[model samples]
Target chain A: MEDLTAVAVHTDVSLWGLFWQAGFIVKLVMVGLLGASIWTWGIILDKSLGFGRAKRAFDRFEQVFWSGQSLEELYRNLGDKRTTGMGAIFIAAMREWKKSFEKGARSPIALQMRIDKAMDVALARESDYLAARLTSLATIGSAGPFIGLFGTVIGIMTSFMGIAGSKSTSLAVVAPGIAEALLATAIGLVAAIPAVIAYNKLSSDAGKLTARMEGFADEFSAILSRQIDEKLPRT
Target chain B: MRGSITSSAIIHAALLGWGLLSFSAPTPMDMANSESMPIDIVSDVSQLQKGDKKAEKNEKPAPKPTQKPQTIPDAQNVGDSETDVETKPATETKAKPVEAAEAPKPSETPVAKPDPQPEPKPEVKPEPKPTPVPATEVKPEPEPKQEVKPDPVAEAINDVKPVPAPAETPKAEPAPQAEKPAEEEFKLPEKVAMPQAKPTPPAQTAKTPDRKETPEKPKTQTASTPSKEKDGIADQVADLLNKQKASAGGAKRSTDQASLGASKTTGGSSLSQSEMDALRGIIEGNWNKPVGAEESPDMKIIVRFRLTQDGQIDGSPEVSGTGADAGLLNAVKSSALRAVMRSAPFNLPQDKYDTWSTVELTFYPGAT
Candidate 1:
């Protein structure tokens, strides 16, 4: 009777116990979820850092862009090496402008168009870089739960099998399996929740940053166009 | 960027430490929950005996017919021998020699042969001698002292036979103790007619009382002879028996009620334990722990709620706690609440309303 009571009493199923006791498929599911969760956290960390750095660098570059220095001198000071997000776009547009002047393309419209095209291309490339690996976050968020559920289902199935084999419907018999199974879903959610939230938050931040770059590109092209208008004879 | 990452790492490390700490902390609730009741074997045995005696007395009068065939003949033979000796003693000379020779054998047989074969002869003879001796020596003081001496001898013999016999004839022993001497006189015929109607022994020494009653009554009543003494001793013995029966019955009844009360309380309490476990199992079973919840083991939600008598959740469980990220905390809390809500109407005992009416359960996923 004491043994039975003990069996009945100490029915608390520990998490490690659950995982260790889980079947092959469930264990695989749990491992997969854990991997996904870890990867998601890594992505979150990397993206947040990258976005913060890009935003700060953009702020610094904007300060220098508007420092009222000669555009030629500023471009020269940037050197041949593309330094930052905004600098790279500025360099691409200026380099195309300088080339047009060297080639003696006296047509102001054509010069303005070339500079805009170069800056647009640069903006697209920078946007791509900012948006990189964001899809992984979305994927983890959406798929993590399902993977966890799959593990849970397997764990529960194992528990039912145990119940059938043991021929007793006692909680002690079934609690461990059920707890383990739930751990899978839990891990999945753990992996998925942050990934989902991070994806939403970071994607929007990235989008806003990309928009600012496009705005800068458009503004830079306008300045070049204004310069060409003043330098070329009236068409 | 480095500072933020370091902070995040520190936070994760702290969470990991907390989880480890919480995991290692032993839950005291498990010890509180598994309680055992101690059973008293001695009290139980005594109560059982009392119950047995009460039952025997209550059902005694009804089963007289079954015992009639076995005990009636012995009683009749006893009466006939008593009468022969009593009536012949009046014809002094002729009866004296025969009575003297016969008297010593009866007295000696009881003292010498403690066996069942000589029981009938000794029992019959002892009754007549004690009656006549007590009547002749009317000084009640000497008579009782003399009676007390032989009474123990008779009791010692009866004690051996009575153990098994009382089980079969509990009613006979006590009735014979009260009325055996008086019935040997004019009431002999009636005693024979209702020979099976012996009352149960009030005490352990039922046969000794019978032997004692025969001598005591004859000495007490030389005037009215059988009538007054018969009523006096018979009523006294009867009253004593009734009082004993009443007291035993009362004790047995009270103990019965106590046991019933004990069982009811234990039964209710035990039922609640299982009900609580069932509730715990269902909720825990449904809980899908959020990933990384183990990292923040301190993130616990205390869910308090009331349950109706019929086991239905009376109100929504209120979740209150703070730890981890909002998204993570909310996910864990909602999942915990959802599990409880999903497994609605817990299997609570209706009779034990006070125990489970309100519950405050702590949901710490990995710890549980």
Candidate 2:
């Protein structure tokens, strides 16, 4: 920053200086790019943190389920509060299985079908949560450079107009405008690159998390079906 | 969502601060001017200054030594002859400074005659006597003094109090050329029959300061008649003469304009063409070109003026125009001058103060 300011002192070519001097259209492009970059980074952080939390929750929920605790007791432990991830799938299947007993239902086939349907709906909801905003990341990553190019085009066009008005094709006249223009493209790329990389990494993490939830749902449903057969003896 | 936004803001601030701390903008180092040939206008202008200087020098030596072909064998035996040396070279060289080699022989004798006018003019012309600057200043300081342009230069030299007893007589000649044989008008004719024994004028600078001040008018009128427009500086020399006519003594104006041309020879560089044209346009907007005033003496006027940091005129500017002897040309010169004057305190870029602090503007009045 010391050197940055030193250069500015000698010649006013600082970033802020460029922004201030830029034409209205270029300024608009720069501001828009800035917003996109911030939004991209926000999405990246959210998805990364959310995926990590989901994985940790799934691990804890699986450990509790396999700890030989009674299903009813575990379901009670969920306290009827809104559950998440693998736990939501477990709660949904358990409630369905409990409802069969309360209604004095006799057909194991119908009760089993209802429990599986409940788990499937919960799984789909979790999947939707994991996949949210991923499309926006893809859009920004693909479109960032083109937005930057638009700013550059506007900047260069304005610089040419300056040249015509000045009546001299000297490099000094054109350089500042071009530099200001290029900064827009540079910002666009800066915003885009991280968004693209984060999107790839987080999407993979989310998929792994979903796969774990699906596996847990299958194992819990299998346990319930086995318990039902033993309790009634299928007689 | 809130957490992510806060995280993004923190990350961005950190990134920007770090980038700012580490990044440095690269500055351009000094570079060469791309292939256009650079003109050393000072040398070019000075080289052209020699012709007008020649005609001016011829008049100074004529009033004294009114001898014509007298058989004074004794004076002939005295190999130290002022006439035999100063006259031939004055006419022979025209304006070529090559004969500056012979300029040394008369250094002692020409010292007195050359002292009055050319002395102040050199300091004033910003090296006005381009009569081989090195040779003239080196051989006889007075040789450069020999080119004192305006007749008022004679009075200014008399004012500087260095060389004059007979220099004053030459000063006297300018004011009443009739009283002194109209030497300026007939200076060419006189140069042919010239006996150059004018050493008597150098000693009287102290005696007739009053007599010299009295004679300035006619001398300026006569000075205007003989001035030849050579290069851009020629107009300045004429302007210096005319300025002398206005000021009663051209000496003060010359010294004020010279100021060592210090501002220019420093880190100052020429303004880009656009800058030059803009400056010219601003001045030209105020300039009213004379009708049919489109020739060498009238078409061009150059004014070299100093500017303060705030872009106000620093002092009275030095102005020169060609063929100032004619009334129309004189009007053209003054009108061009009035344009520069009327356009007060110029608006130049501030960051380029070093380059524009002192500007020498060559104005083409009738050009597109």
Candidate 3:
């Protein structure tokens, strides 16, 4: 009669109950996959906020930059603040402009080249920040299923071994071990599906943000080059 | 990053809690969709099977006597052929199955009373027993016993009934009248013993259905049904008559030379499916398919053999039937027989030995 029921408690089928019921190795696998899932979601959240913040900052700065204000005043106003993302690129390029005039302009072409180079470096740093920690999402998405499968294989093997030891083919001997093993796989899938979806979503967002910043740099460099052209004749 | 981690942890914990709360009782599967086949575990076939095999047994033994009568054509002496023809067909027709066998069974029981009324002598009893070679065993026995008891002299000398033909049969014929009387003595005693040994019903059955002539029979029916019973009865009757004549006659020699049938009667309950499956698995395991001939699409091979109690092959398996290319057929047939031989000493239930003792297997060599 005791053997008839495989799992003693109905709670064992629940997520927490299953976690506690799992074998040590299977428990470890489940924990690892869960951690990966949580980490994946965390990265998703941070990236989401970061992309929004960059977009809003770009929107504000673009409004002001396009209003035909003096680039020197804008650069001086940004100098006092610790700026980043798209704003940092504009500041880095403007400082290069100010430096050329203060040092007495050598060549307009050289000034144009230095300002472009400064903006390019700032853009590289911004893109790097946006793309951070995404590779872990891809890793979790791909490896999670395999890890779950390993747990399942081990669980079933253990179940069969129990059956052999008990000398019976009763459902009680079979079902619980198999159920416990399959829970690993279930958790793995749960972890994997989100990681995969979030990785796709967040990476695409990052790509779009980087592309927008690259366009800004290109436009800002052109403006700086034009300002240098105007100053060159006066110098 | 720290805030995001806390938020992600809270979300995962909430999801996990929801999953835990959502666990419901497992519902029973809808049988219409599941469609699982149910099988019963059984130890014996008799428990599951329903039918009387007596009919089959009757047909099987029926052939034994009919073919024997042909050898002792001279044994009756008086219209010897007519008497032989009449008795053999009665049992043979009774062995005909269903309407013919059933109709004659009841008729033969009653008919036994009449055969005795005619001969009313010891000679009559002997002749009746032998003549009912098919259905006549009972008729012959009752008649002979009844006749010999009630009206031996009057029935032998004065009765002109069809059965009285036995006493008169010797007188009317020229060569074998003296021989038949002696033959009846030997055949009757042995035939009587065989029936008596089993049970009254089996005796009545063995003799009545076997005698061929209960009271009277058509010659044609006797000609068709032939088996070991015919050989044994034929030998018994033939040996009696042939010996009395000092063994010089040609037709007598053939009857004299006839051997006693080596047939055995055995019965038990059928084996359960598991036993059959085990037996099949053992055979299939040993069967390494003979190469090059497995592709013969139409090949069919049937092998029949008996097994001993210890699970050893009792005798070499006989290929009872085969249909395929002659060249490929032989390869598969031999391979099947080899498998049967190699898979000896099968571990089977000792109590159910009778059921598994005899087996017939059909092999269709193909992609399977």
* Candidates 2 and 3, the one with greater DockQ: 3
DockQ of each: 0.10, 0.36, 0.37
Model 2 per-residue lDDT tens digits across residues B1-368? 98888878888878877765555354676566342211111111111111222223331112122224433223222232343332234333333233233344334333544555564344444422322222222222333234334345454554343433334556544323222432232232233123233322321222132232223322433343343222234445434442211113221111111122232222234566676667766777887877766544334566777788888888887877664447766787687678778877778666566567667766654444
Interface RMSD of each: 4.8, 1.6, 2.2
lDDT by residue (B134-173, candidate 3, tens digit) is 3433334554344343343453432233344444444334
lDDT, candidates in the order shown: 0.64, 0.63, 0.65
What's the lDDT for candidate 1? 0.64
By DockQ: ranked, best first: 3, 2, 1
**Ordering by TM-score:** 1, 3, 2
Q: Which residue pairs of candidate 1 clash? A: A186-B289, A186-B291, A190-B291, B171-B198, B171-B199, B171-B200, B175-B199, B177-B210
> In candidate 1 chain A, where is summed lDDT lowest over 10 consecutive residues?
A3-12
Candidate 1 per-residue lDDT, tens place, B1-368, comes to: 35544555566557645764576323545565332211100100111222232233331112112211231222212232343232233334343444444445545544543454354545546665644432322333343454466565566565454444446445454435434533244333233333333222222233344445555444444423544455565556445442221112222123221121221221223233455566677777777887877777557677777778777888687887676778888888888778778877777655555556676767765453
Between candidates 1 and 3, the DockQ winner: 3
lDDT of 2 by residue, A1-235 (tens): 9854655455455666677678898999999988888889999888888888888888888788889999899999995777889888888898898888888768777777898999999999998899899889988898999999999999999999999999989999999899999999999899889878878887888788889888888888888888877775465
TM-score of chain A of each: 0.91, 0.90, 0.90
Docking class of 3: acceptable
Docking class of 1: incorrect
